[model samples]
Target: MGRWRPPAEKKSKYITATGYKRMNDELKYLWKVKRPEVTQAVKEAAAQGDRSENAEYIYGKKQLREIDRRVRYLSKRLDDITVVDRIPDDQGTVFFGAWVTIADEEDNEQRYRIVGPDEIEASGQLISVDSPLARQLLKKQVGDEVYLQKPDGSEIWYEVIAIEYEPY
Candidate 1:
């Protein structure tokens, strides 16, 4: 059986100032604090001898590998990102960093902050710029209707209710 896979599409390089700072802070913490602590633990575990039977040594190695992987990803992503701190001249229209309110056919209003892929948090309603819904909302002004074709081949409609951008 073949294991070939298609290449992933490129993500937009735009990032809000807050998102940029957060990513940098994570990179700094991983490199200066977490990496060193993990390294020390691995060293101590290795010193205990009989590595094949040493559970602590194996766990330490695995943990170090995961940390290193994250560090590399953060470093590369930071290099590619462009910090967008300026508000668009036309604030009425949707753009990056805009907090947008959208209403569906049933009048259910959903609020989302369009942010960089790296800044998406589990607790917040932040959508990536590369997302299909975000792409449809970009450059759209209040009262403009958006029709999105779902993966299941169904079309859903939404109307832009409001747009706001906070100063960075």
Candidate 2:
């Protein structure tokens, strides 16, 4: 088999101001604080004789690689990101950085915040602006019905209940 794969498609460059700031802060911390500490640790580990059998050296090298990878990604992303700081003129409609509440056909309400991909956290109800749901929600007003076709071939419908852009 060929050890090759197609390159991934480019994502949207739009980002919320808060997301931009958070990513910038993370990049700064990684480059200025974490990188130095890890580099120092790796240097210390290298001084402990043969690296082949040195567990600390191996672990430090792996950790350094991971941190460097993240730093590089953040650098490139920050350069391309366009920060959206102001709220949309139409508060009644969904747009980037809007907190949206949607109700399914069964009357179950779900809330999500549309944000840049970099700002997505596992603990929050944040959705990527490029996501299917977010794409459908954009420019949609309250009481509008949205029909979303899932990747699995099933379709789902949602009604916009509320939309707002608030400071986080």
Highest lDDT, which number? 1
C-alpha RMSD values across all candidates: 1.7, 1.7
lDDT (tens digit, per residue) of candidate 2 on 26-140:
9999999998998999899999899999999899999999999999999999999899899777799898999999999899999999998878899769999988899999999
- 1-168: candidate 1 lDDT, tens digit per residue: 999999977888999999999889999999999989989998999999999989999999998899999999999999998999999999999999999999999999999999988788887689999888899999999999999998899999999999999998
Superposed on all Cα atoms, model 1 deviates from the true structure by an RMSD in Å of 1.7
- Which residue pairs in candidate 1 collide? none
Task: For candidate 1, report its TM-score.
Answer: 0.94
Candidate 2: worst-modelled 10 consecutive residues by lDDT: 115-124
Scored against the true structure, residue 84 in model 2 reaches a CA lDDT of 89
TM-score for all models, in order of appearance? 0.94, 0.92
